[model samples]
Target: MEGRNGDAVSLLERYLKDWADESLHAKLAQVFAATNMLQDSLSHYQAALRINPQNEAATADGPKHIETTLSLF
Candidate 1:
């Protein structure tokens, strides 16, 4: 996906529609985090956490993203 974050997001979102995979949501959240789409990233991060609170990626990275997004306001 060579920096094609949009493509990655589209793929993850498409698959997520059929099945709510925690890792997919986590990955999508990271992709959005890398871009300026903070809200989208936060949503996915929350989704992943909702599915599996023990998810290390979401637990670790989600708060950082949320804090960063919140700081923007």
Candidate 2:
């Protein structure tokens, strides 16, 4: 389980490095959030938003996610 989790993380990191597109970044943020990696998730989300302030998903869904993630602290 641990090794699988590590592999998944590595894959996500590679994806982030290779394709920094907003949608992919958002997906990665969600994955990080699901894994309780709030800081990393927030960072990715912020990057996504920065890349596309007019992003439909970010504009429509990001604030809620950010608030929820922040509340986890």
TM-score of each: 0.84, 0.65
Tens digit of lDDT per residue, candidate 1, span 36-66?
6788888888889899998888989556857
Kindly give the number of clashing pairs for every candidate: 0, 0
lDDT agreement of model 2 with the native: 0.73
Residues forming the 10-long window of minimal summed lDDT in candidate 2: 55-64
Residue 42, model 1: Cα distance from true site in angstroms: 0.6
**Whole-model lDDT values for every prediction:** 0.85, 0.73
Candidate number achieving the greatest TM-score relative to the actual structure = 1
